[model samples]
Target: MKTIFTAIFIILLLSACTKTLDIKLRSTEPKIVIQGNVTNSGGPYYIRINKTVDFDANNEYPPVVNATVSVLDSNTRRVDYYKYTGVNGYYISNNLFGQVGHTYKLTVTVDGETYTASSTMPNFVGINQLDFVQTKILNKTRILPQVTFTDPAYEKNYYVFSLAVNNVTYKAFYAVDDRLTDGNEMVQQLYMDSSYIQKRDFVTVILSSVDKNVYNYFNVLQANSGASPTTPSNPPSNISNGAYGYFGAEAVSMVSQSF
Candidate 1:
């Protein structure tokens, strides 16, 4: 009877220790996150990787590590691969970022797990007509440029417009307010009223490059909010880098007009 009792006690003690060990192992595993956006519409693009916070807790952005990006064009069958740059968990590539009609895909490996995503290049809506004129707001001089373009209207589409002035060395400032279409309020205001102003001597406007996913997000928002950009419930933080930066995407837009 004594031997049996001792054996039972040993088994119970081992079971309790095993549970504790499992909890400790879970705590030590790394918490990581990864996100990316096209910084420029030009050939060279950057994939930004970052880590998310612990379960609903606020945490600083953590850059991703050891991630690789491979791009293949559907029509060209051309392949390009990018290696992670040590700066801010970014992968840099000059030749593989995007092309007018090509499809792009991304795959990531982290923590012994693999994640995959793909996006097709949004149609490049060249600006057939662009101009900037003077206007006044609040009795103060505010430079505004009015842009017009025909929507290609794909099955699912998203668009971003970028402006560059002077040359590649210098940048110009302006805002789209929202997407453009026929006879919308913002578009109407841009044309009928003297609301448009010129901020610079000339500026080049190009359509923004986005995948079908982001396009669907904005398209739905536009249908609900009209052409006006909605008021932000939670404004962005001091961090000024991501997709929301001043000139978030590339400016390789070839369309240009002189004031």
Candidate 2:
């Protein structure tokens, strides 16, 4: 999925060189944004709880403290809990799980209401190679990262790849599913603004194998935030109790490239 900022940049730059947009965001009642994830890479994984801010307000997310959170392993029937770091709405898990085919359930109780989500860790898929290839976007030549991986056959698979430059992760995530090209040697190109890519910059690409629910959440989010995004609508959340954000369990493969 292209990031909102980078996608907007491509849309404007490729279309008319420059354009103006006037978006008026309406104020809505504050809702909590609870996001958490578990990876096969291991833990103490993180969970963040925050409330959405007003449109006219400063760009700040108010943290939701005093919430009780837990991650339970369905396979082992053991429970792993979390502790708030006392800032930034961050909660770190203890005794995390990394086993495949295990379902994990996350429970967060806030203000006497409980919100929950569950995810199962899929089988692992590793990146074969990483390459920086030149491509054209709307007649503009741009160098983008290409990842090579062998897609597994027979099962439905979904993926999300995220990029980080010099240890700073970009907010834009790329999500794709094995629809027509299942069981093929796939070369997926990551499209983003690469103007700041300098010589010898460390680049990291993480490919996540996610469940269908988690995939849908990010797929709709990616769609709504694409170039020439349509009327804004909320992305589907897997969390119960009407919360915003997602709780995901992913089996990930990571590859890094320099220069």
> What's the TM-score of each model vs. the native?
0.53, 0.85
Each model's RMSD to truth, in Å? 19.1, 8.5
Error of 2 at 45 (Å): 0.3
The ten-residue window of minimal lDDT in model 1 covers: 16-25
Candidate 1 Cα errors over 4 Å, as ranges: 1-42, 53-60, 74-78, 94-97, 139-141, 153-157, 164-204, 209-211, 217-259
Which residue pairs clash within candidate 2?
Answer: 1-174, 1-175
Candidate 2: regions farther than 4 A off: 1-27, 138-140, 194-196, 227-230
* Clash counts for all predictions: 6, 2
Tens digits of per-residue lDDT for model 2, 106-203: 99999998999999988888999999987777787766778999889998899877777776655566779999879998889877854445678888
lDDT of 1 by residue, 1-259 (tens): 5664344333212211000000001112244333344322444445555654433343345567766655555567776676775665556555754455555555555656555555555555455556565566769665655665554543333454434444321221222323444223222113223334344555545555455454443344334333333332211211222221111222223456666
lDDT of 2 at 66: 91
